[model samples]
Target: MSGEPGARRRRLRELLVDTAPLRQSPAFAKLWTGTSIAQIGAQVTIVAVGLHVYELTHSTFAVSLVALWALGPMILAGFVGGALADVFDRRLVALVTAVAAWLSIGTMTVIAFLGVEATWPYYALAAINAASATIMGATRGAIIPRLLPTQLLPAAAALSGITMGAAITVGPAVAGVLVASVGVPWTYLLDAVLFTGAFLGILSLPRMRPDGERRSAGLGSVLESLRFLKRAPNVRATFVWDLIAMTLGTPRVVFPAAGALVLGGGPVTVGALTAAFAIGSLLSGLFSGPLGGVRRQGRAVTLAIAVFGACTALFGAVLLVTGLTDAPRDADTPLIPAIVLAGLALAGTGAADNVSAVFRTTILQAAAPDDVRGRMQGLFYVVVAGGPRVGDLIAGALATLLALWAPALIGGILILGIMLILLRTARGFQRYDAHAPTP
Candidate 1:
């Protein structure tokens, strides 16, 4: 109600995800476009790195080590990069990390072209690339709120959901074909070149120093951020609720078993289930215009999360029913109806999760102070990185001990119950206002 006339008007057509965010700010437009391309390129390298390492070592465990090596560095970078973002110009921090990632990609390309038989180099480079990317992402996230007015935060977050959805959905498929057709070397080279799009965006940005007190990049600054998160109920809500939802409801661990066991479609069934989630997220972004007008963002996030819980439960139920009333599945014939039903349920979960992401991201950027925002985003990236893995573990444990569908069934119900309770009791979060973000 407080924006410009055009924003206030919000034409009926605009209700279907208009391009107002892109049109309103050229800086944001460039950064968004560039980051979008960079994510696709990054995904390409992520997949290619796995394939390359596997080809060299011929061991899945070795391939797993590549990811494992990246994890430590990425976690460290969150705190360090955040502190750096708070101390130095964010533009500088982002640029440096982007270059580091690009350099690592370029090195991988050269090594691959030279037919390096050693696996250690690839492992080292992959870790560096992942860490640099984490830093870049954290710095970039902190920069978004500065680039756009508060009114446009929801729109920007929605666009980000679209960007991420497309990257994850399209990038892996392209990487598979590219690696198969050309080789790992070319894939690395392509990623290196594509990442220049990120540079273009970073280079275009002006010097962005911390707005308030400057903090040194160290343990104390990081601790300060942790303390801030503890005190800020709204901000804490974003992470706590997200962690609960992910830890309990991640159904991906059962995808393989579900496909081969009850579903009987094998890898194709697994692929379908995975793609359905991304498709749902994409669809939500495509129709995200209405979300921009929501003023009570905390409530919006709560409702979205609650819906996610229901969907997860529904997904589990679909699997449970299929497993119960199913005939002996042939390897050649999949239970098409069950697969469709399960995919739809997962899709619903994806959409609801994305809706929660949109509001939560908006809240983080809108509510958090500018000086330490980078570290906050870094912490967010850590959560983003680790939450799903924990969720997968929960799913795996439940499926191992009980039924393949048990994780979703039990986890979803838990999420629903906890969320409903929180909605009634967490008065501050329930009453949080978008116009005046508390966190």
Candidate 2:
């Protein structure tokens, strides 16, 4: 009986997410701590910005223009910032970009307090903030591989998942409360304060210069990274798979319509759906211990993404059922069964996406040479940021033409089919081994 208890404890330990990366690297620990905190503030600002825009224009389309205005600049900054990270001191680049982002937030706070009602200022400031953030993200992602041993890359990725989960989950909730109670200015001011934590973390890192020949930060360097990607089939496959997943499986664009027309919970339902997805992601990160031990990373990524598609499809089915059943559409009427089903399905998607992210990130860091890691990470950021925007467009257009659930259902099926084809044809990606990490 005593031996059985010991075995049970061992099993539990194996199931929990590994924390060795945090304990072993002081710099990483500090960086992770600061990023996690700052990300929450960032989320608050994101939500607050949207809310403020809506308040000014009383139009959802105008509010969405905020993201539209920021997207192009953010994507451009990602590539440029990534090239710069390879040429300059990565730590310095991150620090400077962090300060730029903080200033943008400060500007927003000032605008709010001064009662600046002009929409153009909000658009301009948001664009600056988004571009700065893209640069900082690209630089920081490249810095992680330097901070830890190659073997611990998966753990670092898992930790990042936890950070994202926490930030998305806590930040929006707090933002909603603050915006309702104190106001948008207070929310922006709080983000400005939290921004200091990120600045300190970057400041604490030692200077990190490129380990190989430096590339100039321009179109040529970006083109060079693309040429390298052409030869790196496995790394390229990671990007392709993620783009497929995000562009097809993402369903956030349908949430507002789902809540109002189908799910019958209005804003409360939308919040619950979003929270459920984040909660699942957080739980997956918490229990990601066995992920680091997985040797067939390519297979892991494929399987996880397949699961993601399946879950998204299930969510769509729930929506379809709710719409067909003539479920109550009023905000006051709760379609409990459909709502529960949709939430669970979305949660499953969150878990699957997090698992896929850990492997995809680990593969990128492990396979890419240090010389072009920043550039590769930069391209990764572009895909990460751009895919969702494209997905939003696809989902919105499809949902408008067919039904609220049509995009998710059709897109999920498309993701699964495409992934299968890729798996069958892309033997290089399928055979990729974490232990060897060949690109």
Worst 10 residues of 1 by lDDT: 8-17
TM-score versus the correct structure, for each prediction: 0.94, 0.98
Leading candidate by lDDT: 2
- The whole-model C-alpha lDDT of candidate 1 against the native structure comes to 0.89
Model 1 residue 75 distance off true place after TM-score fit, in angstroms: 1.4
| Per-residue lDDT over 322-402 for candidate 1, one digit per residue giving the tens place of the 0 to 100 score | 889847665567999899999999999999999999999999999999987998899888887778878878898999999
Error of 2 at 156 (Å): 0.4
Clashes of 2: 0
Clashing pairs in 1: 367-439
Cα lDDT tens digits, model 2, 270-323, are 999999999999999999999999998998899899888988899989988788
Clashing pairs in 2: none
Alpha carbon lDDT at 390, candidate 2:
95
What lDDT, from 0 to 1, does candidate 2 have?
0.91
Give the Å shift of residue 379 in candidate 2.
0.8
Off by over 4 Å in 2: none
